[model samples]
Target: MFKRFQTKLLQKQVAGGYRLYTHPANASYVEKLVLSWDTRRLTQAALETLAIIAYKQPITKMSISSIRGVNSEGVVASLVLKRIVKEMGREKSPGSPILYGTSNLFLKKFGLKS
Candidate 1:
């Protein structure tokens, strides 16, 4: 099945020997998937984490927790899965924690220019 997809130009190889593809004639559907927020609701914790990441990005999880007064690892993971936030990179601190930031999709969903 995978070979058939490759032969039909439905998939292409990328770095690290991975395959990437998009559904043909589904740009609108893909856009909806990326931009639509009405289909799912975010928990309050997730929303708070997202707000912090958007304003204080590229911030570390520890910093976010410090501001929110709680650990936000799970909330951050949810935001990452929702494509609202992304892992920017690791910080230069003691543990080299991952930095988080809002994604381009987040900007699009919120109708922001930048």
Candidate 2:
């Protein structure tokens, strides 16, 4: 479909089908100035916890807290709520603590191939 001047249309997968959105067409030829208002952010603690989970995934909460030298329960919960990390399964330890790993959303958000 067509769009306004200096803009291009792109398709994205929706629940049932594809949806079209506008994007800049003449990126190499045009210099556009716009305000930066991107919101979603992560704290230092969250970032540290995320790095640990990304590198050494399928790990338990205690393991993460032990490695980080602080309680990571809140950070992990926030990551899960953000859909970046997920519950993979339970560890075979005595308590059978839940194991956490990155979600598909994390892979896509970071542009990493599964």
**TM-scores for all predictions:** 0.64, 0.64
Per-residue CA lDDT of model 2 for 1-114, tens digit only, reads 234532565678999899866565645333233112121477999889999999999999999999999999999998887778999999987989999999998898788997
Candidate 2 local Cα displacement, residue 33, angstroms: 29
User: Which candidate achieves the best lDDT against the true structure?
Assistant: 2
* lDDT for residue 83 in candidate 1, whole number 0-100: 84
lDDT against the true structure, each candidate: 0.81, 0.82
In model 2, the Cα lDDT at residue 4 comes to 56
Task: State model 2's lDDT.
Answer: 0.82
